[model samples]
Target: MLTLTDSAMSKSVSISNIRLYQFIREKCKIAVVEKNQATDDPSIFTQPKEKWVTMIVNNSFLLNLFIEDIDFKETCREEQEKLEKEKKRLDNNSVKKRPKCQQNYITSKTNHDNCHYHGAFVYDMNNHCKLTREQAQTMTQNVKLIASNSASGRSMELPKLIWDCCLGLYGIDPPCQVGSCGLPNEMKGQAIKPGQDLMTLVQNLFMNNQAAEKRTKDFS
Candidate 1:
């Protein structure tokens, strides 16, 4: 399961930050689903492959946003530096009037402590995806529901997709460009197929749903 470190949690109190974190978690779940699907069924490789690429691109974009917003890299650097300093201090401690065997044991303990801190840092870096395999399967079902609706021309707008799943929480619109507040026009009106790209698929589904709604009201 993905988890925010205490520092990350403390910094993510704002609505936007919380949403960003949630978005990352969801993408991780989706990636897991895509990976499993591709592995299980080679016939649909092209579709899942495209979706996986989209997931990676979008996730990377969002993660960069999160890192910048939360100053995550700086925080990690500071933490690592502190650990290094503590290790150095322990290493430089004077061994006063101790037996040679006792001194060896103390030195070994200090090394063990340093190794433990390093291992923890590595674990924190690696273990961010929070979903179990069962949970990922459930998430796959949800994605398929949306895809099936889209395929049947009964496209339903997902509330979360309205903001491209994350940016709306920051009071921004979809297709935002990096290092700028202005929204990009690259994806505007771009036609996409169901299961091609998750974000675009959802956005297209939303648009189709809106058009259908308007037509219904007009006919009525």
Candidate 2:
């Protein structure tokens, strides 16, 4: 019978070795013929032939299977390493730096002149147009007083007070005026007339409770 040596038997049988042996037995007619010849040669006592030719053929078959297994494992390892490298590269690319303006929006002490301006009390691109802290406080007080008077149904002094807040004494332009310090054209229309009433202005700017609430929150 064909048998492996003690040392060969002691070696572990890998999956590749079994698969290769099955392939050779099923598909390789020439190799099968050669193996049969080698197997029968020993029994026939062929003239001037090597002693263990069948053993050599079996060892060579095992060696080929072992080589195939090693190559397959090495290729798999190389592919895995390439995929890991690609993953790391993509992870590195995914990280992005934030914009300088957005990163320092709240903490930055430096004023940005290019940024849009809203009103006198609020900071604007033109720092010269921005009101001082004292002026802002006084405006807030004036607004509160106006709101109080309106709540009390005191309509007599409202026009004068509103005009003073907009144009006359305070010299503060209405927030709905066009230009850099004013709201966008979509939000505000043509500049306020010399004697436009506060209710009319409020209705024009804030047509909904949501907008009015937002304005109130901003003031608060």
Candidate 3:
């Protein structure tokens, strides 16, 4: 039920870009799956959350995702039931649908090897598949897609933790000389590389002025 946004709604993309998105993601079908169309919430992407959208097609364009803001759960009974139904459907109709002269697609690993697939065919492994290492990787990704993590009930909190450790830990001050409060880190300036001088340093310091000032204050 997620709608494309201004940054991601483009209809045309280079074939390589599309492949990048797909490469990072396992299955595009379920990366943002909805249970039902009518009652489904369209607000998943609008929430203040960091969502990841990986597609093989757009290799470089990692789009943000919209999902339910809360963690959810359901009785496994229905899911199990649907999978069983899918198995039966494939078993009953695959022979008629598959062509005899069709090229073998999923030629990677047997059993779980093979190529990327979707729907009932994914769950029912005996269906059409591609037989290459690439296909194997694709199939692996699809399974991961179906195992979507939308049920988790928290915002994208992990990133906050990372930012806290890397930036907040420095207490909004310089790189060294204890801190505005008192803590110790290596008080020396960063090592310079050969041929790198004031101009290069200036560009780098633009982003870390606070750190430079803090360092100066510390040393003085």
Q: For each candidate, give its TM-score against the true structure.
A: 0.14, 0.16, 0.14
Question: Per-residue lDDT for 1-65 in model 1, tens only?
Answer: 23333584473322346666676655544422222243566575453232331324334455565
At residue 25, what lDDT does model 2 achieve? 41
Better of 2 and 3 by lDDT: 2
lDDT of 1 at 196: 62
Q: Provide the overall lDDT of each model, using Cα atoms, as 2-decimal numbers.
A: 0.36, 0.38, 0.32
lDDT, model 3, position 53: 48
lDDT of 2 at 50: 22
Q: Per the 3 Å backbone cut-off, how many clashing residue pairs does candidate 3 have?
A: 36
Worst 10 residues of 1 by lDDT: 116-125
Tens-digit lDDT track for model 3 on 1-220?
1224445545533334545445434443332333333436776543222234432323333333211221223335556898898888675444321111121322221222222211011111233221222344465566556556557634331111101112221112222211121111232365657875533343333324454334333433
Number of the predicted model whose lDDT against the real structure is largest: 2
Task: Report the error of model 2 at residue 9, Å.
Answer: 23
RMSD of each: 35.3, 25.2, 34.7
Candidate with more favorable, higher TM-score: 1 or 2: 2
Residue 128 error, candidate 2, Å = 16
Give the number of the best model, judged by TM-score: 2
lDDT per residue for candidate 2 within 1-220, as digits (tens), equals: 1234457448443444565556644443222211124554555744332222132344565667544533322234456899998887775555332121112222122233423222222322223233432444476677668777786765333221111112222235433322222233444566667875533343334333344334434543
